[model samples]
Structure formats: C-alpha cells, structure tokens
Target: MSIKQRDANKNLEQTKSHLQSNHAIHHQAKKNLVQQPVTRFALFLLGTAATILGIYAIARHFSWWQLPYTSIAVIPTEAAQASLPPNINTNFVTAVVDRVGPAVVRIDAAKTVTNRLPDAFNDPFFRDFFGSQVPQPGRRTIRGAGSGFIISPNGRILTNAHVVDGADTVKVRLKDGRSFEGKVLGADPVTDVAVVQIQAQQLPTVKFGNSQQLQPGQWAIAIGNPLGLDNTVTTGIVSATGRSSSDVGIPDKRVNFIQTDAAINPGNSGGPLLNQQGEVIGMNTAIIGGAQGLGFAIPIHTAQRIADQLVARGRVEHAFLGIQMLTLTPEVKQQIASDPNSWLNVDEDRGVLVVRVVPDSPAAKAGLRVGDVIHKLNGQSVTEADAIRQAVENSAIGKDIRLELRRQGRTLNLAVRPGAFPTAQVE
Candidate 1:
C-alpha cells in the first residue's frame, strides 16, 4: 500500500511542474508579441522627426527666403520719420562745409621782436674773443594765428581788428592749402572789423546773408580754427539778435551783436558765423567766461558796412563829438559827490554827465562843460553815454547835431557841427 501511494504522488508533482513551466513560457511570448508593434511605431516616429529637422536645416543654410529691403520713402509719413534720430539730415551740414570751407582761411600774423643782450654779452672784449658766440641784439619772430573769410573774388578778406593788430606781416593759408602774403587794407577798432587784401584772383568768396532777417532758434554753424584747429565746426541755434555791446561786456565796441550758442573759443574770433543756408550772417567775436552756450558775434551787416568803408579808403571816418561822458545815476552821483578827487560832479542823477570835453572839439565848440549833464540828443533821451556817441556817429559828418543839456539845474539846447573822428583817438 505505501509504494503505490508514493509513486502516484511523485508523478502528480512532475505533471504540475511541467504545466507551470509551459504557462510561464506562454506568458513571456505574449508580452513580446504585445511590445513588438509599439517598438516599431516609436522607431518610425523618431526617423520621420529627424528627417524633417534635416530638411529645415538645409533650407535655412541655402537662403531659401530672404528678408525684404526697406527704403526711407516707405516710412509712410513724417510722424513715422519722427521716430528717427534728429541728426539724420547731417548731409546739409556736410554740403555747407563743402561749399564755404574753401573760402575760409587761417591767418598767421608775425611780429618782429627785438631783445637787448646783457651787458656781459655786449662787452667789446667778449665780442672780440667770441666772435659769433657773443650775444647781440637778437631779433625774434612772434606769431599769432586767427581765422578769416574771403569777401571778394579779387582776394578781399574779412577778419577781426584784433587779429592782425600790430602785426609786422600777415600770412594767409586757404583751406585748399594755398598760401598768400596779405596786406592789411584797414582796421577799425570801433567796430572791431578789419579788411585784408591778398594778391590772388578768382578767389572763392563767402555769400553774405542779411543778419537783420535772422531769428532766434534758427540753425547757426561756426567753422573756424578754434585753438588752432583748422576748419573745426560747431553747430547751435541763434540765441538772440541786436545784442548791445554793453550786454556783451564790450561797451567800447559799436557792434550790435548776434548771440548764438555755437562754441566760440580763442582762435575762432574772426571766423564767419554761417546760417543754415550756408551764408555768412555774422563774424564770431566774443564768448563770456564762466558761461556755457553763451557766444557773441558781430552782425554781418555792420561788418559789411565797415568793410565797405575800409575798402573804399583804407580808413573809416566816424562823426566825433569829442567828449568823455558817464551815465549819471543816483548811486553814481552820490559816489561822485562823496569822492573829493572826482571831477565829474553833476547836480542831476538821471542824465549823462559830461566828464570831460576835449579841447577844440565839437563838444567844446558847442559850449559843453564838465559839470553839464546831457538830457537828450536830437530829441532822443540820453540815459546812457553811448546814446549820444551813437547818435553823433550816425549823423552825417559836418551836419549840425542838437544836444539838450542841464547846466546848473537849467536846461539849455545847443547845436554844433560834428567833425571827423581821429582814427588814432578812436576807442
């Protein structure tokens, strides 16, 4: 009975184990069958994506489609163009420089300087011992440079009076590199205007514009040898016009200045101030210290008139009253009375006091006294001393000028004919 039972159990166990192995194999085969279709689909998708990326890269590398070019005309309107930088129209400046730069010149003035040698060097024994080694009276050249512009084809140049003043010789260098020896035709310190004559014919001339028509906020350009920089250009707007000489701190000069914000330095004194049309409107003159964007120029009309007078006769003759005067104010009157040494003692505080009347002059001939205060000139109120001088200068030479004076607290009207102003005795 035991042997039969054991043999049956072992056979049953073998059969169960065989069935479990077959079931395990069938499960693995079913998993492989299910995963095969998904693997193939994933590989196909990856290959298609790679192929599409390669095609795109090739198309981009070969410039398949290029961006369209844009023209300025296509900007549509001014409002759209307003988004652009302001200096885009710099071509106008470049063109103006090209047009007028050739006429601009650099003036180098050289003066003869003589220096005396020391006593030791001047000794006869030292001179005998050291022949050429001993120092003698040495003559050295002192040179100064300024700016100017040609005004005529026959080589008439315009510049400031201070530029070539006291210069023994003047050398002009044009922008095109031509050099010429210039002769000072005339120099008027009253207006600070000078005329130079060169020998060249067919010289380029700058076009002159009416400075009276110039308005503030108009474009102004200054081209000059500022600090010896040739043709250095600066741009700004016209700040003002008809600026009095007193306003510019140069009461001695009779200029009605054109004020601009364009940079004006030491060497820019005689350079021409050009308008937006590339025409000379003024002559660059003075700049105030401790101030930025404050530059003054002499009006071209005044300069032109002076230049005309100079060209006609090597000199300008202004009407002369021959009197030193001061604008009498309350403070000035009190200061004059308080100072015992003061000669200008006036009773009135609201008139121009005659400080001194030159001997044998028009004012002296008109019976103007030191204590007399001028109230009016030709019916115009004389609040400033320059007003009388300006009126006298504006009147024709030899014409009778009427002056109202307060002498000893009494108003007196006097008439006198003006005479030619001595150029040497001018401001």
Candidate 2:
C-alpha cells in the first residue's frame, strides 16, 4: 500500500470514533432533560400536602376543626323569647289587660231632661187661638256611658264626676257578667273625681302607682268602654307630664294632667290609664277635638286625693284665691304699655300678672289688686300663672299663703288666707 492511503485510512477511523462519542453524550442529555420536569412536579405535590396538613393541625388546636365543614343555626328557647324586648311583642299589654280587666267596670247613667216650649208659644193671642191645643213641653231621657275602676274590695269605685252628674239611675256591669246599682257617694267637679258605692263583697280592686315618678316616653295603656264598646283597649307612650288644666283647655279643673297619645273618646273619661306593671297611673279624661294623638289624663295621685275626700266628706273643697291672671312676658308687657284702654300698668316681666281680682275674694281681701305682678309664692319663684294656681290648690282652706308681688316698681310681701272654692261656681 502507498503511504498516503494508509494515512487516510487512519484519519477516517478517528473521525468515526469521534462521531460515536458525540452521539452518546447527546442521548444522555436528552434523557436527563425529560426526567427533570417529573422530579420537580413530585416535589411541588409533596410541599402542597405538607401545607394542608399544617393548616389542619392548627385548626384542630384552636377547636375550629368543624367550622369549615359544618353549618350552625341558632334556636330560641322559651326563656330567650321571654328575655326579648318589650316592643317586640304585645305580651306586656296582654298581661296588663288580663290582670286589670276584672277590676274595670262599665257605667251607664240615665237622667230625665225636660224640653221647654218657646216663648212665642206662651203669647196671649197664640194661646187664645190654640186654647189647650198649644204644643206642650216634652220630657226626654239623656243617657250617658263611661268607665270606672274598683278601688276597694267592698265595691268602692273611682270614676269621673261628669259620668254621674245629674244621673237618676246608674248601672254598673262587671267583667263576670254581674250588674249592680251604683250610688254616687260624692262627686268633685273641680277635680272631676267621684266615688261610687255598690253593695258587694270580694270585688277585684286595682293597684295604684306613683304618678310623681312618671316620665315622658313611658308606656301608657287605657282600657275603657269608648263609644259604648265595652272592654276597649288602647296603648301609647306618655307624651308629657305635669300639664296644666289651662294647657288642656279645661281651666275649671284643678289638676296637673298626664298628657298621652292614647286614644280617648267620649266614654273613656273615667277609665284607668295603666303602666307596664298593670298599676293605675292616671285616669283617661279629655282629648283635643280634630287632633290626632292628643289625649289628656288626670294623674292618679290627684284623682285618689280627690276621691278620698269625696268618700270621706261627701264633697271636696278646693282652696281658692279667686284671681284671674296671666303669665307676664315681654310681649304682654309691651302690649299693655302700648294699649290706651288697658287700664293697667305692668313694669316687670317674667311673673304672673293679676289681670283681675275677684270682688270680695281672698285675693281682694288681701289687697291684691289688678296690675300687680306676682313674683313669688311662699318664698318660691313663680313665673307661670299655673304655678300660682297650683300653690293655692295645694294650700289648705282658710290657711294663710305668703305672696311676693311687684306693684308699680315696688316689691311687697303679703299674706292671704285662701277660701273654699264655691260649689255654685263649679256647677
């Protein structure tokens, strides 16, 4: 063989060996690249499982293992329902009515009312022409209905004076379907409180609450026979307290009334206004005409006070100073000063101004004349006329009351003895 052929043969063999080595290395690299992704996926799955197990252990430690898997529902028991708010249910009212219903009564009063003939019928020419044919006066019956509450076990009931006023017959009906003839023991028109006696035993009586502690926004429930409907119940909140009689348009009454939004019709006058505990707090009395949610009630304290007097003495004598007055304000003073025929001079403001002093009354006897501005009563400052009236009402009859007045820029102190309110005036 030639030397060139031998060299070529050797170079070919070396190239073939080099190619085989490169192919082996490329196959191993391809196999490793395919296995790398599988190993990474298995490691990721193991890490996720560990995280889930750790979370389960923490939940079991906190006793919240069932929180994510279980649903919870709340169920109220009887005690839970009872512990709920009062406004959520009418159970309070129902309880009150059930407790107090038996003591409430229906009062039906009847009176004989005579109708008189006109004056023209009595003329001489007409009488002569008619000659016993003239229309004669007719007699009729006036019937009224109201409500009352039993105060004593022996059938002593408290009601409004107007309920039995001029009544010839009074019939009382109870909840147990029993009726009785009621006799008026006494009636005080000033306080509008009356006591009726019925011969009975073992009667259900009412419990009275303190009206002086009453506040606005308290519950008020009224049970009455309004418009001839028996056992009518109404509910509302107390709108205000200590409302003057004048503020309620009942100047003749001498009561500090409890104002409520409860429904009060004609026949609800004497019914009991109860509190949440079923205690009598007031007496349903009056309501403003054509106004919604405006009703007034006499305080239970005042009603009981007057009722006691009526039962004990067959009458109530209210203390009277007999003076017509008004609260003095800057506008009133200015009006009086500007008027030519006011016939009075008011120099001070923010006091009760005596517009007129009744002749021969306790005020007049004590030299309390018109134009005097009453500044104080019994060492207490007085700004409203109702305050003076209340002071006089609180005073005993024939007892001296101290008065401080500003008359023509001079302050004077006087003592006046109150007199009994006249029955004729009340009638």
Candidate 3:
C-alpha cells in the first residue's frame, strides 16, 4: 500500500512541476514583448531629439537663419559714399570769377615806327637828288595787345607802361564789347605802371586788397585776356612772395613781384591777380619764358602808389645810390681771388660786391670805394645786388641810408643821402 501511494504522489508532483515551468516561461515571454516596444519607442525619440539639436547648432554657428530679436542698420558702399561732394562750398571759384571778370579790359596799342636809311645813303649827293629832306623814311605801324583794369569811376585805367609807352593810339575794349580811345595820363617805365583815361564815367573799378597779407599756398585767381582770349580765368596757389623784378631779368623795373602759379601769358600784363575774396592783391606783369606755372604779379600796394604818382605828376622819380654792384657768390669770390690785378679782395662770400662807383654821385660822395663789400643796407642784410638796388629805389630821396661794409676784413658804416635817379643815366 505505501508504494502505490508514493508512486501516485510522485506523478502528481511531476505534473505540477511541469505546469509551473510552462507558466513561468509564458509570463517571461509576455513581459519581454511589452519592454521591447517601449525600448524601440525610446530609441526613436532619442534619435529625433539628437537630429533636432544638430540642426539647431549648425544654424547658430553658420547664421543661416536669423534670430527674431536682432536689428541691424545698413551701410552704404564706398562707391556710393564717394559720390558725395566735398564739405566746402563747390562754387567758390566761380563766384570770384563772376565778380571781377567784368572790370578787366583788353588794350590794343599802335605805334608808328619809322625805318631810316643808312648814313651812307644819306650822303649830300643822294640827299640833293631825294630833295633836301633826304629821302623820307618808310613808316609802319607796330601793334600790340595787353590787358588792364579800371581803377577809378572816371574812366581811369591802370596798365603796364610797356603797353602804351610809344604807342600813337591806344584803344581799350571792355568785356561788354564797348571800345574807347584811351589817353595816356602818365607812364613810368621804372615801375612799369601806367594810367590811361577813357571818356566813360561811372565805370566799374577793382577793389584793392592788402598785398602784405598774402601768404604762400593761399588761393590765387588770375583774370585777363591771354593770347587774345578774353576773360580767361586761371586758378592756382601763391608760390612765393617778395620776388624782385631783377630776379626775373626785368632790369629796369623796381618791383617786388608776387610769384604765383596761375597762368599769365603775354596779353595778361596789367590785369588783376585776385585773392579768394575777389580783391585785387596784385597786377599780373610777367611770366617766365618757356616755363609753365611761373607767373609774377606786381604787388597792389606798389602799383597803387605808383599809379597815384603817375596820375598826379607826369613822371615818377626813383631814388639812386649811384653804384654798380654784384652779388658775391662762390664763383665770383673765386674769380676775384684768382685775379692778381683785381682791386677787389673778398674774404666773406655773402654780401654785395661794389664793382664801380659813379664819380661825384651819392655813393662816391659817401666815400664808398670799389671792392668794398656792402653787408647791410639800413638794418637789412644785403644778399643780392637787386636787394640793394631795390632798397635804394625805395628809400626817400632826401633820407639818409646807413650802409654797413666790410673792407679789408674791417667793418665800416657810412651814411649817404639818396638823390633822385636821373632818367637819362639809367642803364
């Protein structure tokens, strides 16, 4: 009986054991199915989040897409900015030209030149056959053109002395095409300034400016009839000031020219060299031949003073010291040193060397000797022959001039009263 019971119990236990194992396996399979779906959904969500983050980082780094919170102002390109005009007034030059262009006049001068026969042809035999008057010389009219400006309301005009010096008739043509016959009030060759009068009244006159106030690099405007071109305006800057007329080879003139770069041609003489304010600071007088940007003008102050004298008196008298001198240069000093018979012995190389002294003249009366080196005139150091010459001309006729000289390595001072320059004695 125990064996049978034991065997039944064992079979039942075995069946129970098999059913429990089956149930355990089925529960684990169901749990695995549920967790597999959850894991797949989480992996998909992580991949999507990672892709979105990568796209946002790329956009931020490259600025491919702008944020809504930012604002920027646009800037113009260089080309667009360069198209703007300068801050200064662009019409300044035009305004100055418009103001002074009308007062400038063109002068046409005609002179009768009589060509004479040779002295041999004027022998007594030929003179008798040609009828006692000796054959009359052929006469021809020489014509020249220049420029000038009105200085007074009564038709008084200012021009260069050379313009109408020997002219039989002088004609002035205005910018408005009205022509008038000009009468020579007076002409001073030493100053190269002259005044001509027309019949017209209430004419326009140029305003004079202070020539002493001119500075280098200041704007200069020149208005004149150059090469027969009427009312041509040229613009440039002041190159220099206080240039002597002899510096430009005008030996007879006693003018300190105002050097400018403004174009001045042959016909531009006596025209105005205006400042930026449209005031006449100078009178255009000469130009360096074959050189561009080399023009000179007489200072307005000098021209005005000379004009007043020529208008009041028939002639202007210049002061004379009566000495011929040369600037002491290294070459001149060497030449003087090499010459054994030269009365001049120059130890210093920077003064005016007096070469000749006119007998009984102011310089000779003052005891100025040949070979004496003039170091200073008054208080100014004399460096050039022209400087001393200009100083003499500018001094008062009766004024005493103190001359500092170096003779034989000794400094000497002498005083001289300048006399009137003889017109016939001028070389």
Candidate 4:
C-alpha cells in the first residue's frame, strides 16, 4: 500500500511542475514583445531630437537667414585717424587720410566791402517771415570762412568758386600753420574749380586718383578747411553716382559725382574728396539741403582738367560744335526721306538730333549743318549727352579727330580740331 501511494504522489508532482514551466515560458515571451516595441520607439524619438538640434546649429553658423544684399554701412570712419597713409588697396581708411591731408588747405577769405544788406527787414512786414531781419544796405565789414586745397607745390590752391567768388582779400593757410595772401588765378563757375597761386613753392600737393573706378561702399575721406578749420579730415563711403543738379539752377548739366554720407559742413566746400587710398578723387562742393551726411563732390577728373586749364590760360576753352542737339525724337524720323543722298546723306533717326548750327564754330568750320546726326565720336557710338562731353573732354586741345555723322539720311566723315572748353554760362 505504501509503494502505490508514493508512485501516485510522484506523478502528480511531475504534472504540476510541467504546467508551471509552460506558463512561465509564455509570460516571458509576452514581456519581451512589449518591451522591444517601447525601447525602439524611445530610441527613434531621441535620434529625431538630436538631428533637429544639429540642423539648427548649422543654420545659425552660416548666416543664411540675413538680408541678401541691400547697401547699408555699419560704421563711419574714425575721426582721429588722419595720420595713417591711405592706399587704395588697404582696408584701413587712415591710410587715405595720410595721402591727401598734407595737400588739403584752409582758406580764410575776407571781402572787405561795406555790408550791402538793406535795413528794410526791420519793418514789421519783413519781420514775420525773416524774423526781424535787418538788411544793412550800408557799408559794413563782411567776413566769412571757406575751404581750399593746394594742387601745386608752389602754393597754387584749388577752392570753390563761391569761396573767393567776390572776395576782396584772400588768405591761405597750410597744415604747418603758415598763412599767406592769395591771388585768384581763375575761377570757373560752371565747374566750380578755381586756381589761386601763392608765393610759396614745393608745397605738399595731393595726388590724384581716377574717380571713374571708384566703387560704392569703398572708404571715402573728406579733408577740408571746415569752418576755418584747416586740415579737417572726415570719413564716409560713396553713396551714389551720376547725380544731377538740374533742380539747383544748374540745369542742362551732367555731373558724375561721388556721394558720401560723411559729415560735411558749410565751410567744407572746395575740400578734397579722397578715396581710401588717400588720393584726391573729387572736390567736395555741394550738399543736399541742410541735410546731415549728404555731401557731393565734383569728380577729380573734371576738377583736375578744369583747374589745369584755369591755372594755365585763365579760362577753359571748350570746343564748340556750334550746334543745338536734341535727343532722338519721332519728329526727326518724319523729316528723313527714304532716298538719302549718295553719300549716305539720308536722315537716320536715334541718338542726339541736331537742331541748330552755330555760325563760326569748329563745327561750322568743318561744314556741319543742322539736321546732321552724329552717330559716333572717333570710333565708338555716341548714346547720351554725357558720352559726348566725356569724349570731348578726353581729347586734348587742338587735336584733330574724325567723326562719323548722319546727315539728311547720309553718313559722312568730318575732321575737326577740339578746342578748349568754353564757359557757356547757362542763360
């Protein structure tokens, strides 16, 4: 009976153990499936977050999110950096100051005449607008200040036409602090370049650079005698180009000006507009309407040419074609006939149209007539009025050049000598 009971108990225990093992295996398999999915999902989220942070870091490093290209400068040139040498290639503006600072001068002009202002402003009618202004028409001493530059070593200064415009007595100052009486050599109101020669010789003369090559945002320096302050140097950059003064009474004019945001005051006129290379690229002449940092200068190419002529001959002998020209108009085409003369003497439209012919000018001498269309100067085609001016300016005085012209529907060749530019004071 003991043996039978032992066998049965052992079989029961074996069956229970087998069932427990199967259940344990099933539970382990279920736990593994759930844990594997959760682990994979957590790893994927961590990888995505790391990738986003990396991309953000790269974008911040590259500055791709900034303005593409609008021209705006950050800082103005330092004021106290006049001693450094200004080289065109150098980034430092101080180098430019050193180049032209020696040549820039101070002009102390005095018109010793009785004040010509009238006292009628003291009347109540004038007081309202002019604020109790008194016009002293009587004689009173009138003293004023201006700026100038020494173009030659022998103290020949270049100043504004207005500075010594009506000055009775003029005094020039050097950087070293010597003052000398100056006599006006010649002043051209059209170009605003004047030549004044002093007794001094071997003076520090500023070098000239080509303004035609000046680029906007390049460093610019204005060295002048501002407010009687000699050798005053200020800094800025080229703001604009090819500006016209048609609004300021000087209409029918073409000026390739260097615009700068430099701080230019009234007395800064006639100062040298220098490039970062410290070369005189232009002459500071006018500013826009009491505006701050809006200054304009005459291209040095124009100034130097005019100054050279004024100093040499006391006048600019602009060659005269003695003809009136108009931009190519539709009316001009109507005038041209289909059958132009044998010498290509047919009316060709486009470009400047000749309106009138002057009586004894070089053009008249060269047998040019009204209705003659000039297509090219030398060999290049003429497109604008500025092109003609620039071409004629580049020519030396009395240089014979060939012109290709269209007249009455005929193209012809005309040879003429360029004369000195004439001062055509706008009527």
Candidate 5:
C-alpha cells in the first residue's frame, strides 16, 4: 500500500510542476509583447526628433530661414555665400554722397572791367594823328565760375569771397537744375568768405560738423562743381590741419586752412568738405599749382564765424596795427645787422621785427619804432609774423593789446589800442 501511494504522488507532483512552468513562460511572453510596443514608440520619437534637429542645422547654416528679432550666426561657407545677391553692396561713401549731394551748387559771377588807354596813346601828338581811330576807354564783361553750398533753407549760400568780389551779377544753380539770382550780402577778403542770398525757400542745406574734432586719417569727401563739371564727387583723407595762411603762400588771407588730398580744382571753391557722416567740416578753397594731391580748405568753424559777421553787418571789422614786420630768425637778424645802409639794429635771434610803421597809424601812435622787436603780444609769445597778424585780426577794434618788446637790450611793455583795418588795404 505505501509503494503505490508514493508512485502516484510523485507523478501528480511532476505534472503540477510542468503545468506551473508552462504558465510562467506564457506570462513572460505576454509581458514582453506589451513592452515591445512601448519601446518601439520611444525609438520612433527619438528618430523623429533627431531628423528635425538635422534639418534645422542645415537651414541655419545656409541662412535659408530667419526668425523675427533674431540675429543669424553665419557660417561663412562658400556655398552659403554664393546664394547672396550681388547688388547688396552699400557702403558708407555712397550713403554720404546720397545724403549730401543735393546741397552743393554752382556759382557763376560776371563782373564789368574797364579798359584804360595807354599813356602813349593818350599823348597830344598821338591823339592828333589818329583822333578818330584812337581806341577809347571801354568796358568789358568778365565771367567766372565757382562752387558753393546752401547753408540755409531760404537760399543763403556760402562761397569764396574772391568768387563774388566786384561781381555785377551772381547766378546760383542747384543740382536739380533750378537757378536763382544771387545777391552778395558781403565779402571779406581777409578770410576769403562771402555770403550770397537768393529768393528761394525750402532748399536743401548741409549739416555742419565740428571741425575742432577733426583728426588726421579721417575720411574727407568733397562735393562740388570742379572745372565746370557739376556735382563732382571726390574722396580722400584729411592730410593735415591748422596750416597757417603764410604757410600756404597767402599771407594776406587770415585763415588756418585744412589740408587734404581731395582733388579741388578751380571751380571747387566754396564747396563743402564733408566727413564720413556727411557733415560739413571744411570749405574747399585753394589748391597748390602744378601739384598732385595737394588741396586746401578753410575750416568750417572759421568760415562760419566770418560768415556770421558778414551776414549780420554786411562787413567784417578786422583789427590792424599798420606795421610791416618780419619774423626775426637767426638769418633774418644777421641780415638786418649786417646791412650797412640800414639804421635798424636787431640783437635778438627770435621775435618779430618791425621794419616800417605807417605814419599816424596805431603802431606809430603806440610809439612802436622801426627797430622794435616784439617778443610777445597779448601775453603770448610771438615767433612768427603770422602770429602777430593773427592776434591783430582776432583783437576787437579799439581794444588794448599788450605788447612786449625788446629794443637796445631793454624789455619794454606797451599797451596799444587796435584800430579797424583800413578799407583801402582790404581792396
């Protein structure tokens, strides 16, 4: 009875174990099937995300798309650059010309000059021989052309004084082909600045920049009518600044010219010299004869200052001392002392030497002698003759100027009142 019971129990237990093993395998297979769908979905999502990121990278590298208010990080690849348009080149120079080209104008002046007969032709015997055939004094019209720029909307223009000096009529022509009759308000020969007014309104005017802030190597653009060419554009850099009048071989003019390499021709005078920002920094005035790349301009500040006075009073009052002076360098001093016929004696190697004093002039009345060596004027050292002239030009009429002089091994301080420059001298 025990052997039969043991065998039956063992078989039943083995059957139960086999059934349990099959159930466990089926449950694991179902679990794996369920997890496989979720894993495949996660992999699909990752692949889709990677594809989207790759497309965005390519588009951004090629600048194919852009977002609002966003800056693109350019890759600078050749393929990317090849896609850009060729006409997209706009630089600072073109921008300046487009902004400032309208204000530049052309000025034409006509003056009547009278021709005089020679003294021999006017002789009694010569006149009697050809009484009817003798050429009589006649008048002829002289015409000149130059450049100018409008400073005010009402057609107030600024040009070189020499352009309109003694002109019987002035004609101003704008870039848009509009012409106007110009009236010369005044012309100052000392500074070579003149103001012309026309009866027009709402004209384009130039924007003025501070010349005091100008430096070497800064961009200089000139817009003017050069050699009868209207609206000519030239570009160069400021070569130098603060060139004295004597340094430029124009001692009669009281201007500290701005030197530039910009091509300024005969008709370029009174044209605006512009900076990079299209603001006027100077007025083109002169060019060295037979020289390449050498041009001079009046600082806009000085021109404006003189122009203001001329506009207000129709004239400028420059102070004068009425003395011909020479800067006493070593060579000049030696020449003066070595001369046997000259009565003047110069003992100093430096200072301004007065060679002649006009009778009854400010220098004569101030007791300034011919041999006087002016060491200082108005508390400033004087080493160049231009310095004294500049000081006199800046001095107010009837204002006292302190002069430090060295005469005969003695230092003398004298206060002299400056007088108005004679109109005869300015002509």
Candidate 6:
C-alpha cells in the first residue's frame, strides 16, 4: 500500500469519529431540554387537569387544601371534616373542644406510706450481717400525674379507676387554677371508669356525646395533660370501634372501645376523647406503643351509665350468665363444622361455646347447658363470647329472651330468663 493512501484513510477515519461524537452530544442536549421545568410544568397542567377537575368541578366537596388554610392553626375545626352518610354537619371539632375543654382536669395523685418488710422476707444473711438489727429503708409515698374530666358542674369527675385506685391523696386541677383535694367515689373494674368527688361547687362539666353515633373516619380529638403539659390537644380520626382486648380481662363484659389515631401517650389515660363536636365520646385509656396509629378509648356509653350508678348508688349491679365461654378460633370452627347437628362446646366459626353452667346462675336457670352453642339472643346474633357477654349485660335482668341453640342435627329455640347481677362492693 502507498503511504499517501494510508494517510488519507486515517484522516477520513478521524473526521468520521468527530462527527459521530458531536451527533451523540447534540442528541443528549435535546433530551435534557424535554425534562426541563418549563416542559414539566406544561405537562403537569395538562395531565393534572383530570385530577383537579374531579376535585374542584366534578365534586363540590372541600378537601384538605380547599378547606380554610391558615398559618394560625387555631385548633382543628370539625366543620372542616366530611360528615358520613348524607354529610350534613359542620364545626364538630369546635363544638367538642369548646364543650369539653373546661371539664378536662389535671389529676395529680400521691401515695403516702411507710414501707414495711414483706411478711415473706426471711433472709439468713440479714440476720448475721446486722446482728438482728438490720435497718430496712423506710417506705415513702410516690406521686403520679395524669388527667381526667369533670362529668358535672357540681364537681364530679370521671377518670380511669387506676388513676386514683390506690392513691393516698389526689388533687384535681381545674382550668381556672382551682385545685381541689379529691375524695375517691367509686371505681368499676369492668369498664375501668371511676367517679371521684371534689369539695368544691360550680365546676366546669363536659357534655357526654353518644359514642354509638361515632363513625369511622370521624375526627377524634384528644385533650389531656400529657407529660405534665396541661391542656394538650391532639387530633386524628376515629379509626374503628368495638375493639376488644384480652390483655384486660372482664368476663361478662359490655365494654366497647373506640379506637382513634390521635397521639395518646402514657399520661393521656383518663383524659376525654372528644368528637369533632367537642362532645365527650370516649376516655383515652391506652396506647399501643412502638406502632403508629394505634390508640384506644373507653366508649362513653358504658362510661356514662357506670358514672350514673356510681354517683347515685355508689356501685353498679350486674347480671350473671353463669356460663364460661371461649372465642371460637379457626381450628374450633372446623370442629364445629364436623358436627352441625351436635351441640358444640368449641366452634371455630361462630358463637361462644357454653363451657360450664353455674349451678344456680342465669345460664343455668335459662337452660343454657354445657356444649350448647349460642348463636343469638333476643333476635341479636352472637358471634363470639364477647358478643354474648355484651348482649346479656346490655339487657335488663329478669328479662326472658329466645336463645337459638344447635342440638344434635336440629336447631332448637329455648326461652330463658336472666338473673340479676350482683351489686359491686367498692372499698
């Protein structure tokens, strides 16, 4: 090959490589321009038209952005929340806070005690080390802080029974800086609602709202003295209702808890959980920590009833079913299916099984026998042991109800009368 030909070929190759690189660079520059802010903005306006139209035009309802926006977060307004069903309400949050805030009080509990060695303490080293003169530390009283709400204008307070259960002294602090030494009224173990008294007049009271009216997604407000910060208010929505926990055992229980997402913490116990209308719907009792959006409240329906009894007679009388029951798990359901006609003590799918019938109690008198699977009572269907217990408690004592029982291959209906529950004795 000639030297001149080789040199010409090299020059051609160099020009071709330079042109390819320039074309690649120009193509990338055009692509980058397509992703610029101007281009993206235009696309957003065009693509978001459907979303915006649905929000603003197709539906006239207000959303988070459409509702009044302000930097002055003057507490959440329930009127801003969407009402359930036909959606006809406004300013629930305001009504709730306004009606209940004054009634919400700061509860300060202190224990006064002299420590004594346990009666069971018998250490051999203690006898030798001090020559029978071992000095044990003196007992000291401890103080705990919590919150509660007044149920009456005349100084009756509603709080968790545990809040002042064993306290030597309890101080109730009002919003107006009035502190009253509280006297323990009566506490119920079934619902954990307690009534306490203060030696004062003309106190602020919170109006009780019907908890059964609370719906899922309704706004929930929590007011309490959390971490010693009095009058702390937090907001969320009612996530659910009718939550039951075995962690706190109450057989023949009528507790129906309202669950909320409001930030309830350790000191939130005994505080009023108000609905958007600012009405006391439940009492903040517990928080499942480490997990977000899990908080529980004692429903006001039971609380109010218990409070009335506590205030009037100092105790609540209950009815006895006299039957031990258990929740039907999946495994139990299969066992139940195997004998559709046989009376079952264990059912994985349905009603609580009547385990042991108390000799002379309501269940025994009502003909509720062992192995009888209770499916419904008084026309209401029973799904589990809790439902059975709740239904029975909610009903009046001495009332006769039709019970549906599945006995050997035949569905039997029996009528049984309930016995009056024993009155609670509080010390």
lDDT of each: 0.86, 0.89, 0.86, 0.72, 0.88, 0.77
Pick out the ten consecutive residues of candidate 2 with the lowest summed lDDT: 71-80
Per-residue error for 149 in candidate 5, Å, reads: 0.7
lDDT for each residue of candidate 6 in 105-133, tens digit (9 for 90 to 100): 99999887787776534577666766647
Tell me the alpha-carbon RMSD of every candidate: 13.9, 10.7, 14.2, 11.6, 10.1, 16.0
Candidate 5 weakest ten by summed lDDT: 74-83
TM-score of 3: 0.74
- Residue 207 CA error for candidate 5 (Å)? 1.1
What lDDT does model 3 reach? 0.86
User: Scored by Cα lDDT, where does model 2 land?
Assistant: 0.89
lDDT string for model 4 (1-427, tens) is: 6999999999999999999999999999878875897877987899999999998998887776474877453322453244534543333455555555677777777775665445665667777777635454566557767777787788888888878877788888777878899999998776677888789988888778898887788778888767666667788888877665542335434355678888788899888887765678888988777578788888988888888879778976655455556556456455454436422233555766665666667777888777677888888888555566556656777887677887655779898776554565331
- In candidate 4 the C-alpha lDDT for residue 144 amounts to 69
Question: Between candidates 3 and 4, which one is better according to TM-score?
Answer: 3
List the candidates ranked by TM-score, beginning with the highest: 5, 2, 3, 1, 6, 4
Q: lDDT score, residue 265, model 1?
A: 91
Total clashing residue pairs per candidate? 0, 0, 0, 32, 0, 18
lDDT of 6: 0.77
User: TM-score of each candidate?
Assistant: 0.71, 0.78, 0.74, 0.59, 0.78, 0.66
The candidate scoring highest on lDDT is: 2
Model 5 global lDDT (CA atoms, 0 to 1): 0.88
lDDT, candidate 6, at 101: 77
Backbone clash pairs for candidate 2 read none
